[model samples]
Target chain A: EAGVTQSPRYAVLQEGQAVSFWCDPISGHDTLYWYQQPRDQGPQLLVYFRDEAVIDNSQLPSDRFSAVRPKGTNSTLKIQSAKQGDTATYLCASRGQGSNERLFFGHGTKLSVL
Target chain B: GDQVKQSPSALSLQEGTNSALRCNFSIATTTVQWFLQNPRGSLMNLFYLVPGTKENGRLKSTFNSKESYSTLHIRDAQLEDSGTYFCAAERASSFSKLVFGQGTSLSVVP
Candidate 1:
């Protein structure tokens, strides 16, 4: 089976610029998640969706970061007015709706804000 | 606030050796998962447990709910096994949300 797919494996942006990351989750998966991983740190959940409906986004920076999983299959995470500190890897993951399902992660979009 | 603690923050092993990584949780977790983030920024799922044991290849993992801890053992470590190992605790009642540990950085030297 093909794993999750992400676009722009690497991205470089300047402060105050904008960038968008895209993800195509595994087929037959109903749950999608977006995580941010800083250097030398673990992945931190930013948001998640269940069939086009956002399940959680409390950790997301509402002011500049936004995500949408429209059609419940593909997702896009955008950051507006990016800050230097916003540079980090953006990971997308998907899992089945059943219990104890393992998440399949994409290679991730590595963003570097200069 | 739900916390997952991973031990042996950093470790180095020689080829053909073995090592074990652990995670202790303070939350009401119903399941656990182990992942290895390779150098290319890919997370490979190694094991998923629900208070039991599972083994694959040279990797074995055990989750003990009674003790609120989970363990992952890598046998006959190889250069390909060098990476950051992370354990995530999942709460059944929390709608599949996961809390990840800080991760254990492992290095295998030949």
Candidate 2:
């Protein structure tokens, strides 16, 4: 079985540019999450979805970051007018519908904003 | 304040040795999960626990919700064990999100 998959393993963008990261979650998984990891830090939750509805996004920067899981399977996280501080790895993970289920993570997209 | 605090931000261990990593949570959590991010930047699940201990090969993890802490032990460490270890907790208030610790970078040398 394939794990969670993400596209554009790496991205380099100038400040004020825009970029979109895509994620394809595991099969039959009901929960998908997007996390941001700066260098030397652990993954921080940005947003999450159960099916097609967002669970929580309070930690996300509403002014620039937006995420959507339209079909409940694939997800997209877009950053509008990225800044140098946005340089970090975007990780995607998915888990089954259970309190004890472990998360399956994807090969994150490393973004660098100049 | 850090909701999840990891101990010994970095560590160096010789092959075949053993070491333990710890995470203390400030938030009330019910479950905990441990992951290892390899050099290639892929997060691999190591253990998931609900106030109990689980062992897999040379890796063991224990979660103590009452104490608001968790631990990951790597025994007989190998070169392939070199990576960053993270401990995440599922808060009692949150629906199903994990609050991760800063992480413990482990390097196993020959």
Candidate 3:
């Protein structure tokens, strides 16, 4: 089975620029999640979707960040007018519906804000 | 409040040594997962657990729900094993949405 896939392995943008990251999850997975990893830090949940419906996004910077999984199969996370603090690695992961299912992660997109 | 806490913020070990990384959660975590982010910034799942232990080659992980802690032990550490290790816990109310620890950076030098 193919693991979660993400596009644009690396990105560089100046302040106020915009960037979008795409994710295609594994087949037959129901839960998709987005996490942000700062340099030398753990991955923090930004948002999540369960079959095209957002399950939670309280941690997300909703003002400048948005995510959608329209078909429950693929997802996109967008950052508008990015700031210096927005520079991080965006990681996408997917897992089946279960209490303890393993999550498959994408390689992630490294974003640099200048 | 942070639900998850990790220890040994960083460690350095020589090749052929062993080390353990730990995570403790404050919430009622029913499940735990471990991951390794390599130098290239790839997050790879190492283990997922629910109050038990699982081993794969040189990596072994254990999660004790009752104790609200999890551990990842690396045996015969190698250069490739050096990376940032993160442990995440799923609370009952979160419905599998995991809260992650700060992570432990391990360096195994040959």
Candidate 4:
């Protein structure tokens, strides 16, 4: 089966610029998650969705970061005003509905804010 | 304080050798998942556990819910096994949400 797909494998932006990352989850997967992984660190959850509804986004930076999964299949995460601290890899993952399902991740978009 | 902490932040091993990585959780976790982030930055699921042990080829993992720790063992390490290993835990109160460790970077040299 094809795994999760993400566009723009890399992104470079200046401070205060805007950028968006897209993710296409695996078919039939019910859960989608967006994570931020800084260099030398593990992935940190930014937001997640079950279908079209957001399940959790408490860790998301409400001021500049926003995410949406309109059709419940594809998702987009946007950064209104990027900061240097935003320099990290943006990873997208999906999981099935099984009780003990494993997560599948995309190649990830490496973002650099200078 | 970190909710999940991984030991041996970085390790270098010779091919054909064996090494083990560990993760300790501060929260009450019910399930654990291990992943390897390759050089190209792809998170590959290696094992998912619930208080027991699972083995795949030369890799083995065990999770102890009572002690709130998990371990990943790599045997006969290969160059292809070089990557960053991460262990994430699902809290008892949070079903799908996972808290990740800082990760252990492993490099296998031939």
lDDT of 1 by residue, A1-114 (tens): 889999989999989999999999999999999999999988899999999999999999999999998799999999988999998899999999775699889999999999
The candidate with the higher TM-score, 2 or 3, is: 2
Residue-level lDDT tens digits of model 4 in B1-110: 39999999999999999989999999999999999988987889999898999999999999999999999999999999999999999889977898899999999998
lDDT of 2 by residue, A23-91 (tens): 999999999999999998889999999999999999999999999999999999999999999999999
Q: List chain A TM-scores, every candidate, in order.
A: 0.98, 0.98, 0.97, 0.98
Q: Chain B TM-score of all predictions, in order?
A: 0.96, 0.97, 0.96, 0.98
Please tell me how candidate 2 rates in CAPRI terms: high
Per-prediction fnat: 0.71, 0.97, 0.83, 0.83
Tens digits of lDDT, candidate 1, B1-110: 33899998999999999889999999888999999999887999988788899999999999999899999999999999999999999876686788789899999999
Q: Supply DockQ values for each candidate.
A: 0.80, 0.91, 0.80, 0.86
Give per-residue CA lDDT, model 3, range A24-110, as digits (tens). Answer: 999999999999988878889999999989999999998999999988999999999999999899999999975557988999999
Task: Give the per-residue Cα lDDT of candidate 1 at A18.
Answer: 91
Q: What is the Cα-based lDDT of residue B107 in candidate 2?
A: 95
Would you list the clashing residue pairs of candidate 2?
none
- Give one clash count per candidate, in the order shown: 0, 0, 0, 0
Measured on C-alpha atoms, candidate 1 has an lDDT of 0.92
Give the per-residue Cα lDDT of candidate 2 at B79.
Answer: 99
Q: What is candidate 4's lDDT per residue for A1-114, written digit by digit as tens?
A: 899999899999999999999999999998999999999888999999999999999999999999999999999999999999999999999998977899889999999999
Model 2 per-residue lDDT at A101? 85
